[model samples]
Target: MTLLTKLKKSNINRSEYLFLENKLAFLTTEVVENKYRNSKLVIGLLGFVSIGLVLVVLWMQRKRKGLPIVGLSRQERNIQGLILQGKSNKEIANELFISISTVKTHITNIYSKLHVSGREELLQKLQN
Candidate 1:
């Protein structure tokens, strides 16, 4: 039988079917739109996180590169330079306007960092 004849036999009117069909279409469209919006939001968040992670990695790499290039602080490096210039610890202390004990501490720290035992070893290491 034709669809309208079947509908009539089932006691469902054409207007009712049309109304239900329109409602279903509107609901389906709303569901599809919501899914698209949700997916777009997820993708945007992922993109934002990815960019943030990349920037963080780059910043860490830059900081790491700057650190190992000179493991000594400004004062320690200056102390080493003065020592290399053949200045005695007392002379270095006098020139740098620090105490002799502080000069000794800087020397100890330099030796530990450079893996040297004394001024001779430090000079040898510097030459190499």
Candidate 2:
């Protein structure tokens, strides 16, 4: 009824039959391996594409908002916003639970990114 049954019933030499059986097993194993490899490749590509899409969407949204400090990290952006609201570095440090020096560091990074010399210039730049 099956291929193997027919082979067994046929008048084939033992060596030839054994060779054919081994070849069939080898082919089956190859097919399974190929399928596994293909699925892994597909999954990897999908993950890469999904990450790229998310980044693009975020960039588009940020651009649409016309945020002045586009290049600032989230922490730096928070510092800049607080500065705009007339909060001193010490207040920002207390509110954000960071050291005063850490707040100063974020402010410096924000100033460097926004090309502002000080809080006054930063305020002027963002207000316009």
Candidate 3:
């Protein structure tokens, strides 16, 4: 017999060859499954990133509009500006040369229009 034929016969074993075939099949299947799972993970990460970007865009749009950003009349705007300077009712009255009671009324009106509870909250609302 030829050297190549003799070598092939010496190397061949039916049971060992079948076992190796089964092992290779299992390895191939595992590689394919891992690739599929990796692709799914990549898709999932991209989905989350897209959703996060959309939310950020919406939030930025809202921020650009400012806090509530509703239009204000001249008087309300002036009162709100004065209140932001830590002005008490009497202090605002002295500054505006109005009655203390009128200043209190203006403060109440400002709180109502701003939908806030107190002066500190009002100032915070204006700032951010």
Model 3 stretches with alpha carbons more than 4 Å out: 1-10, 67-128
Q: Give the Cα-based TM-score of candidate 1 against the true structure.
A: 0.49
Q: What lDDT tens digits, residue by residue, belong to model 1 across residues 21-61?
A: 67777998999999999999999999999999999999998
Q: What is candidate 3's TM-score against the reference?
A: 0.44
Model 3 lDDT per residue over 1-128, tens place: 95434544777687766676677779989999999999999999999999999999999987765454365666667767787777777777888788888777777777776677898888788778
Give the alpha carbon lDDT tens digit for every residue of 17-126 in model 2: 89989998899999999999999999999999999999999999877655455778889888888998899989999999999999999988987777778988888878
Task: Give me the runs in candidate 1 sitting further than 4 Å from their true place.
Answer: 1-10, 69-128
Query: TM-scores, in order shown?
Result: 0.49, 0.49, 0.44
- Check candidate 2 and list the clashing pairs: none
Q: Least lDDT summed over 10 consecutive residues: which range in candidate 1?
A: 62-71
Model 2: lDDT to the true structure: 0.88
lDDT of 3: 0.76
Backbone clash tally (model 3) = 0
